[model samples]
Target: MSKALGYKSFGGSDVQEFFSRPDLTPSPVEVLVQVAAAGVNPADHKLRSGEAPDLNGHLPFPQVLGLEAAGTVLAVGAEVTGLAVGDRVTGFALTGAGTYAETTLLLGAATARIPDALPETWAATIPVAGTTALDVLDQLDLPAGSSVLVNGIGGGVGIAVAQIARDRGLVVTGTAGTAKRDLVTSTGASFVDYTGGDVVERLRALAPEGFDAAVDTVGGPSLHEIAGLAKVLVSVGDQSVTELGGATVERRVDRSGLERVAELMVTGRLDPHITATYPLAQADEALALVESKHATGKVVIDLRL
Candidate 1:
C-alpha cells in the first residue's frame, strides 16, 4: 500500500498517519503521478487549525492535507491527451485532492509542462507562488520601474514574487530575516530586515515617499502601516490585506493565477530555488520547520527519497 500523510483530527495538529488504502484509478480526464516533491503551503496549516473553510465536506477520517506537488506521470486515463507516461509534470492550483502522498492524481485543471532548463524542484515551485505574486502586481497598476515593497521575503511566495516583479524591471525592496536578506538581494532587489518591530518606521526611513506597491506575505496589523505607505497592497495569505482602507487589496486563492504561472515557468523567466529538502516520511519535521517561520526559502518534501 502506498503511504500518504493524512490528518486524523483538526485543531492545529499536523500529525499524519500511514494507512493502507485501495489504489485510485485515474479517470480519462485525470493523470496519475508518482510524487517527486510536495510544496508545503500555509493553507495546509490553516485547514488543520480549523481556521480556513473545510473544503467541500467534513474531513474524511485520515484526511490528506497538501494542495500541490511536482511529479512524473505514471499512468494516464483515456480522456487525457498531451500528457503521457514518462512525462515529468507539476500540479496546478487548489482542486486539492491529497497531493501529499507517494502517488497522487491530478486533473487537467492547471497542470503544466515544466521547462527543461528548470529543475523539477523549480518546476514545482512557481505554480502557486508565481501566480499569486504576479496577480498582486497586476492589481497594483504600477508602471514598470516603480518601487515595490515585499514583506516576508523569506517564504516561497515572497521570493517568487520578488523575482517576478524584478523581471518586470521594477525596483523591489524586501524585508526578511538576516539569513534570507541575502537571498532576496541576490535576486537583484534591495533587501531590508523587518525581523524587528517598527517595519513601517524603517521602510519610511528607507523610502520616505513610500512604494507604488506593497506585497505582504505575512499578514497582520502591519498591513495598516504598509497600506498607509503604498498605493496598492496585496496579501497572499487567507488573512485580510484590507486594512489599507481605500487602497487596493487582494487575497490569494486557488484557480486565480496558475495559468500565467505555468506560462512563465514554461517559456519565461523562473529559476529553481530549493533551499532545503526532506523525505516524505519526515513531513512532520518539514511542517515544524515552516511553522518556526525561520525557513529562508521554500521547504519541499522530496517524495523521491
Candidate 2:
C-alpha cells in the first residue's frame, strides 16, 4: 500500500485527510514515480476547495492533492521511452494521480530527466511555478531594458517571474504585501507594498511613464487597479483578467519547459526558494501556510520525512 494526503470532498483545509491505497500503476504513456518530494502550490488548495473543477472529470472520490513532484522513476509504461527505472526526474501529474503521495503517475511527455547535481526538492518545484513563469514571459516577449510590473510578486510563480525577468535584462517592479518586502527586493525588483495607502499613486511615483508589460499573480480589485499600468497584462491567478482586456498566462507544461527550468537551476540562474518543507504527516501545516497567502517562497512536502 501507498500513503497519501487528500480530501474526501471539496471544501477547505479542514477537509484534508490521510489514507492508504494500493500502489499506483502507470498507463501506456505514463511513468510510475516514487515521490521524494511534492511541491505545494496555491492550485492545490484551489482544487481542494472546489474553486476549480477537476479537468479530467474522472478522478476518483477522496481525490489526492498535488500537481508536481520530483523523484526516482520506479517503473515506466510499455509505450514510454528515453526514461527507465531509477532515473531521477521531475514532472507534472497530468494524469490526476496527484503527487502528494509516496507514489504517483506522471505523463511521459511532461516528465523530464533532472541533472544529477540538482537537488530533488528544487526539482520538485519546476513543473508549475517554473514553467508558468517561463510561459508568461515568453508570451509577453518583452525586450531588454523594458520596464515590467509584477502585480502580487510574493508567491512561488511571481518570485520565479521576478528572477527570470531580471535575467532577461527587463526592469522589474513588483507589488507585494509588507511581509514579503525583503524577499521581493532581494530579487532586484523595486518593491511596492500593496497593503499601503494608494497603490496607484505609489506605482506612478516609481515608474513615471508606466510599465511596458505587467504580469499579475493576485487578482480581483488589485488586478483591476493595475491593469492600465502597462501596455500588456496577463494574470496567472484569475481568468477574469480577460474582462479587463488582459488574459491569463499561456501555460506550457511540457518536457522542454521543464528541461529549461532544470538547466536554469543547474547554471545558478534560478532558485526555487523553498522556504519550508513538511513531512507527509504534517501536510496540513504546509498547505495552510500557502493557503494563508503569507508564504515567502516555495513550500514542499517531503515524502521521506
Candidate 3:
C-alpha cells in the first residue's frame, strides 16, 4: 500500500484526507514512479473543488492531487520506450495516477529524463509552469527586440515566461503586485505593479505603440484590460481569450519539449524560482498557499524530505 493525500470527494480542503491505497500499476505506455517531488498549482485545488469536472468527473472517488512530479522510475509498461526502471525522470501524472503519493504513473511519451545537475524540486515544476511558458511564447513567436507583456508575471508560469522571453531577446515587461516586484524584475522584465494605479495607463506609458505580444496568466477583467496592449495574445487557462481576438495556449506535451526545457534548466537559461516547499505531510499547507492565488514563483511538495 502507498500513503497518499487525496480528496474523498470534490469540495474544499475539508474533503481532503490522507489514505492508503494499492501501489499504482502502470498501463501500457505508462511508467510507475516513486515520487521524489511534486509541483503544486492552482489547478490542484480547482480539480478538488469540482471546478474542472471535465478533468476529474469520470475518475473514481478519492482522486489524488497534483499534475506534475519528478522521481525515479520503478517500473515501465510494455509499450514504453527510451526509459527503464531506476531512471530519474520528470513528467505528467496523466493516468489519474496522481503524484501526491509515494507512487504514481507517468505517461511514457510525456516523460523525460532529468539532467544530472538539476534538482528534483526544480524539475518537478517543469511539466506545467515551464512547459506552459514555452508554449505561450512559442504561440507568440515574436522576433528579437519585439516588446512582450506578461500579465500576472509573479506566478509560476508567468515568472517562467518572463525569463524565457528575455532569453529569446524579446523586451519583456510584466504586471504584478507590489509584493512580487523583485521577483518579476529578477527576470529582467520591467515590472508594473497592477495594484499601484491605473494599469492600462501604466502599460500604455511603457509601450505607446502596444506590445508585440502578451501572455496572460491572470484572467477576467484583468485579461480584458491588457488584451488591447498587445497585438498577439495567448492565455494559459482562459478559453474566453478567443472572445477578445486572442487564443488559448497551445500545449505541446511530449518528451522532446520536456527535454528542451530540461536542457534550458541545465544550461542556466531558465529557472522555476521555486519559493516554497512542503513535505507530503504538509501538502495541504503547500496547496493552500498556491490556491490563495498570491503565491510568488513555484510551490512544490518535496517528498524527499
Please identify model 2 stretches exceeding 4 Å from their true place: 54-58
For each of the candidates, the C-alpha root-mean-square deviation to the true structure, in angstroms, is 2.9, 1.1, 0.9
lDDT of 1 at 177: 85
Candidate 3 runs further than 4 Å off: none
TM-scores of all candidate predictions against the true structure: 0.87, 0.97, 0.98
Error of 1 at 235 (Å): 1.0
Clashing pairs in 1: 28-79
* lDDT of each residue in 83-136, candidate 3, tens digit only: 999999999997256888989999999999998999999999999999999988
Q: After superposition, how far is residue 251 of candidate 1 from its true place, in Å?
A: 8.4
Cα deviation at 109, candidate 3, in Å, is 0.5
Better of 1 and 2 by lDDT: 2
Number of the top-ranking candidate, with TM-score as the measure: 3
Candidates ranked, most accurate by TM-score first: 3, 2, 1
For residues 1-305, what per-residue lDDT tens digits would candidate 1 score against the true structure?
A: 66887666666653556554557678777788887888877767766665665562464666676777788888888877677798787875233356678887877545655655656666566556666677777777677889989878778888888877877888988888878867887888787777677877888988999888788888776555577777766777624555454333353443336556766665756544677788988887777777778877787888878
What C-alpha lDDT values do all the predictions have? 0.71, 0.90, 0.92
Candidate 1 structure, TM-score to reference: 0.87
